[model samples]
Target: MNSGDLPPSRPLLVVDDDRKLCGLIRDYLAPRGWQVDMRHTGPEGLEAASTGDYEAVLLDVMMPGMDGFEVLRELRKTSTIPVLMLTAMGEEADRIVGLELGADDYLPKTFSSRELLARLRAVTRRSVRSGEAADAGKEWSAGDLTLNEETHLVTLDGGNLELTALEFAILASLLKAKGRVKSREALLEEVSDRRFDVFDRSIDVHVSQLRRKLGDDPKQPRFIHTIRGVGYKLKEPA
Candidate 1:
């Protein structure tokens, strides 16, 4: 498959201990214009994910040696590579745990091929959009948080901050609409290319992660503020 025809900048990486599933994914995505590389064990997956130029990673929660959580936790320390975790069906806790560990999205183990494709496209498209030059030279700032669209660089208190694509997009949305309460629906629409229900808590999870990285306390807030049941807003420090 010619990778240039795909939305992702590079090949997709699928990491699962289940060889049959990995093969199935490769078979499904390849004909659809995505090149896929599979790594079976957690350690191997972590190494490939850390070293490869893949557009995104399809990870399984249950794995050998390190497990997906351990791998994702390690990966997020240095790289913001998009990760779509595969979890058992109806495992809400697994989904939340994966999200908290910085997984961009989660798919059930029994997902349809079409949903899989849509999800893969959605996550990869975010990376492509985030890396675009459309916002070149523009900048947004609130308190110590500064984001340079041209450089795709974010800084807090003069220190560089590495943010996942989703986190960066969410932060940018909030920064763009400074002092206004951005409801989850409005925020999700602005940041995601895929359709997400207004009640999806993934947006809230990303915001929490972003807030932690920004060193803002949810209580006695410094930058991002929860506007009661409305949504969130970034207050310019006084």
Candidate 2:
């Protein structure tokens, strides 16, 4: 097919030991204009991800030598590239661990190619939107929490809070809304271009992580308040 017939090529890195699965992903995504680079080992994947100019990274939770969590931890030390983790089906703990370690999103190994494509697009879109917003050089503050959009840095009570890309997005949305309660659907829409699924608890997980970093108690949160049955809102400092 001619270049005009295909969308602009998006570079993606897949880090997984399953060569067969990587090959399948490459075959499925290549025709759709994604340049898929496969790394069959955690070290190789980490090296490529650190040095390569990839729009996104697909990581598997299980790997030999270095594991996905270790690779993710090392990568987060330098880069903020969007990452979509691949976890075994029914492994809720693996999903939570990936999210806690800064993964942009996660999908089960049994996910359809269509769902994979949709999630990849959603995460990359979110990253681009975040970059654009950051370029605006905006600063937001409520109470002791401060967020610098340009730097994508957040500070609570004069101390920096290390947040993943998704966590930062969630916090930014809540900060923007301030005292207004933001429904889970609204929050998800702001951070991802995908349709909302009531069953998805990814948002909740990220929010809980953010609260922990902010030292906000879930029951009596000083910065974020759960409206229960409604959603969450950033509390105005009294």
Q: Which candidate has the top score in TM-score?
A: 1
lDDT of each: 0.86, 0.87
- Clashes (backbone N, CA, C under 3 Å), per candidate, total 0, 0
Please list all clashing residue pairs in model 1, or write none if there are none.
none
Candidate 2 regions exceeding 4 Å error are: 1-7, 134-137, 158-162
- Model 2 scores what on Cα lDDT? 0.87
Q: Per-residue CA lDDT of candidate 2, range 83-188, in tens?
A: 9999999998999888877888999999998889888888887777666666477888898899888877788888987776678789888988898999988888
Write down the RMSD of all candidates, one decimal each. 2.4, 2.7
Candidate 2 contains a number of clashing pairs equal to 0
Q: Model 2 residue 208 lDDT?
A: 85
Residue clash pairs of candidate 2? none
Model 1, 13-128: lDDT tens digits are 99999999999998878877778999999999999999999889999999977899999999998899899999999888888899999999899999999888878877877787
* Lowest summed lDDT window (length 10), candidate 1: 1-10
